[model samples]
Target: MADLEDEPQAATVAVGSLDDVAPPPRQPPSEPADPAAGSLERARELLAAHPIADGGSGLALALREAPLYDIEDGERLLETDIPRLRDGGVGAQFWSLHVRGELTGDRAVTATLDQLDLVRSLVADFAEGLRLAMSAGDMADARNCGRIAVLLGPVAGPALGDSLATLRAYHALGVRSVTISGTRWTQRTGLTPFGQEVIREMNRLGVLVDLSGCTLETMRSTLVAAKAPVVISHHPEPVPDDVLRQLRANRGVCMVACTGASIRETADRLDHVRETAGPQSVALTGAYDTGSPHAPGLADVSCFPRLIAELLDRDWPQPDIETLTWTNVSRMLRDAEFVSRAMQARRPASTARPTPLDA
Candidate 1:
C-alpha cells in the first residue's frame, strides 16, 4: 500500500475528528448566514435546489472560498454531513481536522489555528444546528436535542510545532484527539522514527492516537508502542506479517474503517490491529461516496453521516465499538480540564494570570 511518504502530496484522507489540529487561517464559510434566520430559509432552499454539496453552493466554489474545511457552507455542514451513513446511526461522528501538510512552518500553524478558531466560532454561530461532542454520551445528548455534535481532531498531530509538549497545550485549547502523521514523515513520531515516543505521550495525555497517514513501518512501530485504545481513523490496516501479532481485536483499540483506494489492506490492518489491540477496537466508515475502497475525496455537509452508516454494516466487535466511538476519545477531552486544575495548583498565584484562556 502507498504510504504517506509515497503520497506526500496526495489529497489527505478523512481526519474523522478535529481533536488535535492546530488552527488554520480562515477561509470564509460559503454561506455564513444561518438558514433559520430571516430570509435565510428561502435563500437556502433556492441554493440547495441546485446541485448542492458545499452548502448548496457547489463543492468547487466552496473549496476555493474556504480553507481546511472540506464542506463549503459552514452553516449547512452539519445539516448535510450526518444523513449519508448507516454505521453512524444518529450520533456517531467521524469528524476530522486537517490542513495541507506540505505547507509547513509558522504560516501552517497560524492557518491551522485559524481553522480551529473558526470551527469553535462556527459552532456558536450555528448553535441551533450543531454541538461539539466531547464524549460518547454527548452524542446522544446532541441527537436528542436534534443537533449534530462536532468532533475536533487534527489531520496530522506532528504539525503542532514538533513536540508532544505542544500537543499537551493543544488539548487545553479544546482539541480532543490527534492523528500522529498525515501523508508525510514528520519529525517526532512520523515515518522517520516510527514516532513511538509520540504514541506513548499521546496515550498518557489521554489524547486518542490516530494511526492513519503512516507507512507499514511507521504504523507497525507506533501501534506496537501505543497501549491505550487507538483509532486508525480513515484507512484500513493491512494484516501484519507473521512477525507482528494482531492484538487489536483483543486489546480493544478503536479502529475507524476509512474510504480509500486500498480497502482490503485497510480492512486487514483493522483486523490485525484489533487482533493485536483486541476488544477495544472500533471501526468507522466514510459515507461521502458509494461503498467502495476508493478514498472519500472530500466531505460535504449532508453526507457526513453516510460515513458513519457505512461502518456500521460490519459486525463491529463489541469492545472496539465502545472504545472507538465513545470511551477513549472521550477521556482525551474531559481529562484535560482535570490536568489544568492540577497545573494551576503547582504554580504561584502571581505566575498564572487570571484569564478565560487559562483552561
Candidate 2:
C-alpha cells in the first residue's frame, strides 16, 4: 500500500497565497512541532505551512493543520498518503458507513454495509497506523499511541436491513451513533411518527441518535424523544430546507456543526445552536470540514473563524475540547468502557424531553 506521503502529486507542492490559504515553502516527510503554540495558533501554522494550500483559507479551517481526509476509490484506506493528516492532526472521523439508499432501497443499505466492512478491513490493514474508535477514551488512547481513531456509524439506519434490531446489530458492530432517517423518511422510521420511536429506542440503548440527514420534524422528534444524548452529525447545513439549517439546537442534545465550511453564518448559527442546545450542547465541526481546496484554513471554515475567535477564541462551556472533539460522541459509544460514574449519573432516567428546539 502507498504511504500517505507517497501519493502521486501534480507537482512538488508550492507556497500559494495567504489570501488563498497558501501552502508551505516545501514538502517534507514530517513537520516539526511549533515550540510555542496554542491550539488555534497551531491550526493557522499548519495552513500557512501546508503544501496543498497556497494562501490561508480562513480561521474556520485554521483551528488545526490536519488535512481533511477522504475515503479512497472504494477500497484502500490511505492514511500514509496524506502524511500531514496521519501524523496526529486529525482527532476523530465519522467514517461514513453511508448507505446510498435514500429513496432507492436495499441496494443502498448493502452498499453502506460494504463501506462499513471496508472500514473494518482498514482497521487491520492500518492497525499499526490506525485503529477503530467509538468512545472518547478509545480516541484518546489512539492519540496517545499516535494512531488515527475511526468512529464508525451508518449514514442512516433504514439501510440496516429493517427494524431496530438491525440498528442494534449495527450498534453491536461498533457504530456509536446512527443517523436514523436520511434526507427523507424510509422503512425504519416513518415520516415523523416512526422517527419518534427510533429516537426513543436509540436513547434507551445508549446509542447516539444522529439528526444530520433527517427533516426538521425528524430533528425535532429525536431531540424531544431521546433518552440518551443525541448529536446532529451533519448540521449547520448550507442545503436549503435542512431542519437544522443554521444553528438550531434542542435542549439536552448536543449539536456539532458540519457543512461545507465553518463560515460566518455558522458562527451565528452555532450561537443560536448553543442557546437552544445549551452551552454544553453546541460545538463546531472538527474534521473533514475543509475539503474544499478553495478554503485553505480554519478561517475559511466558512469565514466563521473570526466570528468563532471573537466569541470562543479562548474557550466555551461543554466538557472542554476533548469532550467536544471526541468525548461526547465517545460517551454514547457501545465499545467504550471509560464512562465515569459521573456520566451515568448525568444520564436521565427517562427519555422525556423538557423542551422542543426552535431550529
> How much lDDT does candidate 1 score?
0.46
Off by over 4 Å in 1: 1-79, 82-88, 182-194, 236-280, 287-359
Cα lDDT computed for each candidate against the true fold: 0.46, 0.47
lDDT, model 1, position 255: 44
RMSD of 1: 24.7
Candidate 2's C-alpha runs over 4 A off are: 1-82, 86-88, 101-103, 183-194, 236-268, 286-294, 298-323, 331-359
- In terms of lDDT, the poorest run of 10 residues in model 1 is 49-58
TM-score of 1: 0.54
Model 1, residue 276: displacement in angstroms? 8.8
TM-score of each: 0.54, 0.58
